[model samples]
Target: MSKQVVFHIGGWSSCGFYSKASNVLASLSILFPSRLKVVDHKYGSRDEYRSWLIGTSGSGFRDTFGISKASNQTSSPFAWIESSDGGNSFVGGCDDTLAWCKDFCAPKEEGGEEKAVHVDDGHTKGHGYDYDLVVIGGGSGGMAASKEAAKFGAKVAVLDFVKPSPAGSTWGLGGTCVNVGCIPKKLMHNAALIGEILSSDTEPFGFTAPQALEKGHSWEKMREAVQNHIRGLNFNYRVTLREKEVTYLNKLGKFVDAHTLSLTDKKGKVSQITSSRFIIATGGRPSPLNCEGGELAISSDDIFSLEQNPGKTLCVGASYIALECAGFLAGIGVDTEVAVRSILLRGFDREIADKIGAHMEDHGVKFRKGVVPAKLEKNGEGKIEVTFSDGTKDVYDTVFAAIGRSADTGKLGVENINLKVNERNGKIPTKFEQTSVPNVYAIGDVMEGCPELTPVAIQAGRHLARRLFDGSTTPMDYKNICTTVFTPMEFGTVGYNEEDAKEKFGCGSYEVYHSSFNPLEWSLSEHRGKHPAFAKVIVNKDTDAVLGIHYLGPHAGEVTQGFGVAMKKGVTYNDLLDTVGIHPTSAEVLTDLTVSKSSGKSADAKGC
Candidate 1:
């Protein structure tokens, strides 16, 4: 007797109609003859048939039907199906059964499964894009966002490319902080400190090395060591991206549309890719002086990688970058001079800023205050001839410009979208890191009104990724961020300055407690009595809560970090007094502060 098989195209369900399956079965029947075997298996759903075909087998139906055995078997229950016509068939597992059936029934010209339509309610299931998220620029902000989005199972990619400076200075991955800004700058600062210690702090401890002062420092050795450490960080960043399964592309990206980006590599080869979301974190670069022959002046980007020693250098501008460069240069035995446009550290607390400037000046750094460069000319002696606006002139072996930095958003093609960017400065105006475009966002120094520090960018980027993928709604808090300036005497501060605090809480509404003491280490140096370490705490008179804390001394960053946490927790003046003091430490001076500015008392620390 010839066996007959009634096979459903999809799976058969007793309660549901299978009209499409019936049509497909009718067509199959016309193509086959009586030799076909038909069996009526009442599989309730597609999952049931899939389980029977591929799952562990002990089914009596396999024995009753006496169907041909599978040609191959292994650890998996599913194996190749053998056909009598010398053809082989393969069935997918349960999760792919619906897709397999759709492909089997549809015509080849009609494509496979139908495209899924998604409703845009701020999120779409299975949204169609080349990637779930694409971040432009491999800086601190972009890298943080990429890694964070990947944690939520997002298909993330980051494209970063560094444009060489006019001085031909270019670095690898990890952006400004690792390459040219914080990492290298701090290393150089430490080098200067070591030089100071060797020159002055060795005698009083009874270890007499009189030749140490004359032996001096090696600029080449310091440069090589700092650069080597920076290069290692670049390699580690690449390794981290791979470990996190984030795709990294070394290509410059420009916006083609809201969802598309045009990428260009070093070879000038161009391509395009699309993503459901994009983040801009290109950061910033040092700006050039707006004067003739200004290109001859190197900015902060080239300072750390200079070939030879920067002898008799002249640093222009009164920004932190200017003071930092000059301070290190002077400490390392180079003749350094700074030309200030106006005030030092423009946005910082003026009192602490002047003290830092005074400390540098006392340590052999010259200041040309209230002067701006008019023209820069290369003299016959191959020195930079800097002509001031007031008809004065000076020449130096190297001229360094630290006027300011401009946001790196020029090549981003942000104008192609509806995003609002500052036309003057190229900074994107963002509300909680979200730009005007719904699918695009900006973070880090590239966003207006955001702190230009690396930690700020890192936190903002991670928070943004969590919100986009993990359904989080918490926004980043930008207040009370502790920061340290690596001047000759480091200045660390958090929250409001004394001037701002007084203005905010009325002229006499806040109590300012301050003390000045000499560091213990300084007692062993010849320059002991020249400059004293200072500490100030501002308290709101009404609430007695600490509003601001400032320190200017050795290890200021370490000392202020602890107080920063206290200020964030709303620690009061009495609470600080209640805390026990650590013996003979600069930070202990805070616990002993007893003089307030309102009382007309001298705020000075005596013997230990």
Candidate 2:
């Protein structure tokens, strides 16, 4: 009797997991006369493909392959692939695993160098699955997991619905963070700042900008440039996936049954696929606010595609997104207004948030506090009319809804798999991102635990892959996870805030050491008063342990990253003081701050 075999094909890539997968497939093909085929799934189609693969049940091949479901799954090493054009090719996954298996396999078309090698190992004893383990999702985590498992002689396959990272995209192969989120966003932010400095303050520095300033930092050009760079990343990622021999599938995957997933393409075709183990790093989308007339508002996704700044724009919410976009608009001379309820940035020092607000207002942005839109509608001219709770109204050309974002777990069919979710947001719960379902797990933004920062997501995904497939099961440590808001004067923080520490310790006696100064860059410039730097170190009075480090100034993001590490390592206030300060740098203020014998210590007469 002919046995039906299931392959967990993911996007094209030639890296870690992909390489191991190739070896597993080659060994399996030698063990059984089966032809491995690749499948593609596109968008704008009907139901995705349905494979013969089971969603929840094991196959007769599982016992023969000697594979069993993980009994105590917590966290595991994993990587996955992603591709466009329905799996015609793939890219991005795990570069490390592919590097490890570089010498083992050659491309099928570049064959004739080595004949198929047979394996005499015990790996060929699973019953339900013709192969032992079938890994799903071809993102960085998925690819890494599958490849490592394969190296250990476990059968693995990765699946992805989107296009793989461009060729040689080592980081981009992982997903959005490398492709669209962190890197690109920072680059754009930097470019916008440059535009501001050149246009706004060139004269004060005895340098004159070009006769005619450019309009609003050419959003279309930046978008096109970033997209091209992303395409290159996609290419590099694909090459890595393919070289590793991980099966590439370009289709949207959803739970068809417990152990199986159904993949659909844009053309409505479908394939049923199954895996003994799975990892979900689908990430999150910007949350939507159900404000009246909010239909006219745009989310972060829309902001990415903008070609030009709107004539008049209003940014709603108080998260980093709102502050950053508002800063950009104001910097580029757009008529921008920030409308927020309560104080902005709930996690930062209240004083710092207020200063940032004042800085932005001074830079030409209009701030309206304690008021939000009761309803949003377009007037006869198609302009947005925002009616506030106080019955006052204002019109604008655009409104950005930056309230917040939740995990993108709705279509994941978590309910079908008995995955436990947090009661507050229906988000899948995990100590290290392991869901209730034994074989399935989640990380990154999709998994609810840590702050939703891009680096954190990438780190989580990378660590997950290592533990599951590479025999390293280290849990994520978020004790001092550093984060920043990309406003003009950047704000960054790590570790516990004063209120949290006080509550946890049952004492509100922590010492707050802070310093404020005018940065040297503004020394010779007339804009000295326009930009000020601030730093705060919250220390435990009893232990002198640095509980938190927060900063509002230039290069705050870069500076706070290192500070976060110190805080995580239980660095004390003396450790901060002993560290050699960078000469004449804004960050030096952090280490240079003198702790006061009392609370709320003031700086020198110059505020430095």
Error of 1 at 484 (Å): 0.6
Q: How does candidate 1 score on lDDT? A: 0.80
Report the Cα lDDT for residue 569, model 1: 66
Structural similarity to truth (TM-score) of each candidate: 0.79, 0.72
The runs of at least 3 residues in candidate 1 whose Cα sits more than 4 Å from the true structure, single-residue gaps closed, are 1-123, 210-212
Error of 1 at 321 (Å): 1.3
**Best TM-score among the predictions, by candidate number:** 1
Which digits, one per residue and each the tens of the lDDT, describe model 1 over residues 502-603?
Answer: 677688888889988898879767686678999988887855778888899999989999988887666778889999999978899888788898898887
Task: Quantify all predictions' global Cα lDDT against the true fold.
Answer: 0.80, 0.64
- Taking every candidate in turn, the Cα RMSD to the unseen true structure, in Å, is 21.5, 22.3
Give per-residue CA lDDT, model 2, range 1-608, as digits (tens): 32333333332233344445555544645654453322222112111111111213434222222223422211111222222323311222335324322322211113222322212222224436433445444555555555555565555556655532211122335455555466666777787678767876688778878654744356667778876786687676667666665566666778765577877865879878766566776666666657777778886666655656567988998877888888877776678898888778887667778888888888788988898888999899989899987788899998888887766566666677777776556466765656677667776666776667666755765565565555565666655788888887788988766667667655755777877787777666676565568788888775577877888888888889888877766787888889999878888888877855264556532743
Model 2 scores a C-alpha lDDT of: 0.64
Which candidate tops lDDT? 1
Estimate the TM-score for candidate 1. 0.79
